[model samples]
Target: MHGPGSSGWLLVTLCAATGAYCLLRMRSSVEEQRRAAAGEALMGFGMAAMAVPTAVFTPPAWAWPLWAAVFGAAGVHGLWAARASARHLHHVVGAGAMVYMAVVMAAGPRAAHHSTTAGIPALTAALLLYFTAYVLVTGARLVPVPAVAGGPGSTGPRTGPGAGWGDRPELARACRLSMGIAMVAMLLTM
Candidate 1:
């Protein structure tokens, strides 16, 4: 079977690694954080699968509706999650977009991708824009900000991770930025 090229495989690797990290984060001490990590892990894996080169493994006929239903359910859950914490709105939008992309690729008139068309191109443009912005914003956040001293809200600078792999929140944010970059590249190839 045909397979992904070097760049495609690189994106796949990045996404898969992100998913793995998120899964590991599920073991965090905090229950709420664990739940959020679980959701992110699922999204990471799903996006990795979606990024796979179509030539390698075209999504099966049943995959369209199946993924639609799955993402739709995730979207609903994301909405509820957002109600509790506005941060989850991104998750809701991401899930909904996954469902939309799945449908467009599977059932649109230009499904074969024989020619430039409206559906996939438009969707890709939107995703690219969103992910490009996500990458930039998250990348900026990765920069260390010095904490204020003696300030009411200041916790002071965080000490480096000691024995563990890395800080969970920071790692998660890095993963998100990585995936955002990967998605932008993958979508461009469409």
Candidate 2:
């Protein structure tokens, strides 16, 4: 935790803004869409909580352990949910990272210890690398790549309730990008 002018405050602001957006999107979505976007909403809230400025609100003694348990269970469920598609794998990884971070916060000697080998904390370094690659890969996939002409391909861009901006897929991508940026900012702060 730090003052309003500090990096911690900046992180808190960014994460809160993103989380609010996600919640807004969820509220605006229909039942089916809501079901599909549940994971994204969770991600948004999770990131916001993780980035919260400590000075503004100190978590209860049980908070970190509880969060670890919740996210760890979510991660395991995500693995089972990902059996049919690789898409949900990211959720598993993100949830796992959250669990790891919560566990570290709950038990590690953060204030008195520094990394013996590298200046960066081992967990932070690993998470930074993972999220960096994830963001790059996801962004690349989102780029508009032209498909083969008339080769079992349909007409142009989709247009409907679940199409274009504000759709579940788009919102999920936005959430992912925001979380990746937040993770980078957190690592830098550490």
Candidate 3:
């Protein structure tokens, strides 16, 4: 029973933790420039904007402006994806779902994420689905990470910021596992 008065701290916590993991991966080992940039940006935005719309925790009406900003960013992301030259299907679809959620969050005629109406939960579920896919694909594709910079055996991408498996490989897998957990939470809450 998704009831009122339950603070959104759980969602907030999961988002923040996963977001940190992604940011760390981006800063420490991501070789692909575009991937690093996009990953970090999404990490920040997704983490910060996750908790909203609970009864006791309803944001100030003033937050409508912030929600407006959120909607704008998500909307533009969707727009660029639409015009993208060689796009990753995941990003395109993810951004589109977020664009819709941002709209709903901002122009809400009072929508609960877990309401029986299903629309809001459906959108949240879609976002979770996309992120889950990203986690799986990225996690599997992460190359052999290295130990120290010039350890006896260095199996790291020479181009990225650092050469260490401690942060890189673990971060990718962590992102996948954590995001998978978040997906389950989203489904339950929704």
Candidate 4:
């Protein structure tokens, strides 16, 4: 087991890793809603891990430009989905949080690694805390997915619980649960 010296950091890593596993499981599920939820959770994990290294440790000057481009791409792409997922509170909030994280990290992400500077570390700490809360709260929301009831004649998906594998509602719930646990763990660490 990884030592406990950096429990906080370890939790952060664990959440990210577990989130990834859940995503993979989601994909393999015999359900479509599960697939979509897995996919969305993967995106959430990506956003959370984007600037983690920068948040936890200082990097060489060369790292800035590289990270800048990476975070910039993530922010821009997340914005692209921002409009469509606007109706989705989880998506909206999560995407917005990612943008905010990108901005904070880009502003000067290596302070904690360098000379004493409370501002950067303070900001990082605050951002981590906020996002952690966001992940926990948002993950609780229930998204509806359609499920196919009966037989092939009624192959279409229907709402409500008991939706079988490959159904929309089933997929939706799985996505939420998976994302929720991952985010909650992440937030707790922060």
Candidate 5:
């Protein structure tokens, strides 16, 4: 990201750590979680790589198109997976956003800087709004909500003593939230 030295490094650290956690989540006994974790891990790592400060290491011109191609395949995979569960739709959007950023950076100097532009592209603004809402909704879900007594569909917290590290839904939600925040930051830089 085009941030100050410290902030850019912070984003890098945050994303890398998130990617590591997602890798651990892949050990989940649940097949579904294992699958989801694989995709999230890709997003986390990709964001980390892209967020590296330009001054420290600007990728070669060819790297941008290669980046776009990788994410394009990821988006396609996400689209196919979404058929099984709607949750995978988020992955599709995430991959698409990464592709968009890669393409913009490859377009030329002016598009890459973005600040020289008169206004944000409608697509970028739309992506920002989507990610912002995603972050808010995911964060809200993380809050502990009290269970009402004798409520029709009331189920207390889902945590269980036997649940493995990879099986914890809260941690997964947290992982998603972090990625959403990272996406927003990346878009702002674009």
Candidate 6:
């Protein structure tokens, strides 16, 4: 999974781009959106860094523990935030997955290479299932719903200009869907 190759680079690019978009989302006027985007930005960048090809640049011994520590803190923060909004629960899961991966990587080169034997199979399977379900559900939610003409809930094409890019809900959902897919890919490679 960490081999130096085009696929690895593609994963890096995808994650970094997602992180950048999440950073943009942090500019939203909504306080909740800002907080959520901040957490997502952290996840995206963290994933990008962790996805770096091992053959090209294996991290120093200390880096793995640091990665685990950072994501562990993020997970704790997610748990706290989840009290206010259920959506933050997903962040907690993502953070926990990152910590798990980091710990596995820290085990040693042999452990990293033999991922099947290194980590607990059941835990990995559970994480994979969670991410897979998340991807499917988010993808389904992305489907556009047709508006009925003159319906009670119809606002008639949203007066004035549309929302700014950072405030657009559809794009946010797409961003999340992309991350979920990326997480699945990462876990499968593990």
TM-score of each: 0.80, 0.75, 0.54, 0.43, 0.90, 0.90
Pairs of residues at least 3 apart in sequence or in different chains that clash in candidate 5: none
* Candidate 4: tens digits of C-alpha lDDT, residues 1-190: 1113455455456556546655655644355445345546555565345425434555465654554455455445556655666434455444444444444444552522332265334544564566566545545545334546774536554544544343444444555554555544433232
TM-score: the better of candidates 4 and 5: 5
Clash counts per candidate, in order, are 0, 0, 0, 9, 0, 0
> Which candidate wins on lDDT?
5
Q: Candidate 2's residue-wise lDDT over 1-190, tens digit each?
A: 1224366667767777776666666654465445435665676677678777776677777988998988888888788878867777878888887786777667744741456487776877787788888778877766766778885444765578656355656556766687777766655554
Worst 10 residues of 5 by lDDT: 153-162
Q: Residue 176 CA error for candidate 4 (Å)? A: 5.4
Q: For candidate 2, report its TM-score.
A: 0.75
Candidate 6 stretches greater than 4 Å from native: 112-120, 152-162
Taking the tens digit of each residue's C-alpha lDDT, what string does model 3 give over 69-138? 6645655665565565444444445445444544555555466444447554655666666666665766
Our tally of clashes for model 3 stands at: 0
- RMSD (CA, angstroms), candidate 2: 3.7
lDDT of 6 by residue, 15-125 (tens): 899999999999887788898899888999988998888778889989989999999999999999888888889999999999988998899756645635545466778
- Ten residues in sequence with the least summed lDDT for candidate 4: 111-120
The sequence of per-residue lDDT tens digits that candidate 5 reaches over residues 1-190 is: 4577777888999899999999999988788899899999999999999888888998899998998999999999999998888988999999999999999988976875665255887788899999999999999999987667788538654556547877888999999999999999999887
Which stretches of model 5 miss by more than 4 angstroms? 113-118, 149-162
Model 6 lDDT, residue 53, Cα = 88
Pitting candidate 3 against candidate 5, the one with the higher TM-score is: 5
Per-residue lDDT of 145 in model 4: 41
- Ten-residue region with minimum lDDT total, candidate 3: 1-10
- Show the lowest summed lDDT stretch of 10 residues, model 1: 157-166
Whole-model alpha-carbon lDDT for candidate 6: 0.85
